[model samples]
Target: MFLAVGLGNPGTRFERTRHNAGFRVVDILAERLGVPWKSEDRFSWARGVVGDKTLYLLKPLTFMNLSGEGLLAFFAHHGCAFEELIVIHDELDFPPGVVRIKIGGGVAGHRGLQSIVEALGREDFVRVRVGIGKPERRELVVDHVLGVPEKEESIILEAAEKRAAEAVLCIVEWGVQRAMNVFNAREENGQKEAC
Candidate 1:
């Protein structure tokens, strides 16, 4: 069983925020996956089955900063190592719609990832980061992450989530290395367009 976690906070109020991009990716993964996910035993997440594999596509309900609260325990319970886990989250530093995948990298000041590292006591897992666009105002990082994306920005979201959904399928169907090659290192950086 591979654990694919899309990290984000709970609540309808945060539905369209850049911070919730992870949640959007999870929904996409569910929709396009070859196999279906049925209600199964899970914690702070949802379980879906696909192609002889059982996957846990989770959206952390513990808010951004405390994402690992449930995942760490869940990992241990199932004897799944940190390597078997794949995390998806939003990145404000990169342009919107860009997806970056890497293994064992620092959080780059993301509190949620920091929390997850602390909970798991390691940073050797796969991370699928959806770039949600750079901050217009540097000091407003918190607000920007939590703020809702604008109507014009919806296109960026669409592109990034679509890529992320494909990345998830790749990760499960192929492997981390293959997914990284296809998802990351894209020829275009979310198809950068003039503002």
Candidate 2:
């Protein structure tokens, strides 16, 4: 069994914010798989199959800072190891519309990831980072992440979410290595020549 976690704060108020990119990607994946979400243990989740592997899509309701609590509960209940988890979250380093998959790294100031690392006491889980870009001014970082994007920016983020969802499916259907090869090297032009 594989656990795919999308990190974001709960509540309708944060629905379309840049920080909720992970939530959007998981929603897309659930829609594509025709799975319905159910509330359980402080999180919303849907279960489905990709190829022959069982997939669990999770969205923690503990907000960004306490995300690890929800993840820990799910892991304990499902007996899932850190290696069997794939966490999706927004990234400020890459430009908007850029998506990358990696395994085991520092949180880079993402509270959601930091919480997860704290809860799990490990950094071996896979990460599917959906870039939302950084703010122009350092002081605007908080507002930028929590702010809704403009129409054009929204389009870019939407595309990134879709691609990120695909990358998650690829991980389950193929494997992490192949998914990284196909997705991490992708360019804005949709070219996969090289990174």
Candidate 3:
């Protein structure tokens, strides 16, 4: 079974934050797949499935800094191979409307991803980098990412997520490269194709 994990802090407070993009995608996955995502405190996870794939939908209660603990335990408990794992998280490097799906790249100062790499004991797993873009000013970086997108911007963000969900399907069914090619396409002036 393929293991799909979305990275985000768990709680009502984080529900609408841009930094919680991963969690939002997880919700999308749950709805699209009709997965009964039960709250599993034992695994520190929300467990479910999509298609024939067994999905371990997770929101780390350990907060963003220590996400590895939950991820490692989940893998160990399920006996899931490293190849079966895929993580979806946000990236500050790309514009808000884009998503980058690649295999084994640097974490680029993302502590959450850094923690995952450290705990996974490998650097080759696939990552779906959903871009929220860079902040206008360095001082506002945290607030910008963690804060909710304004109503107008929310349209673009939701479009990004819908595309992301499809990309996740392609990644799981085909492979990362195929998904990358299919999902990474843009219009002449640079906008994602319709979902």
> Cα lDDT of all candidates, in order?
0.76, 0.90, 0.73
lDDT of 2: 0.90
Q: Pick the winner on lDDT between candidates 2 and 3.
A: 2
Candidates 1 and 3, the one with greater TM-score: 3
Ranking of models by lDDT: 2, 1, 3
TM-score of each model, in listed order: 0.84, 0.94, 0.87
Candidate 2: stretches off by over 4 Å: 81-83, 192-195
Cα lDDT, model 2, residue 93:
97
Q: TM-score winner among the candidates?
A: 2
How does model 3 fare in lDDT?
A: 0.73
What would the TM-score be for candidate 3 when compared with the true structure?
A: 0.87
**Candidate 1 stretches greater than 4 Å from native:** 33-43, 76-83, 187-195
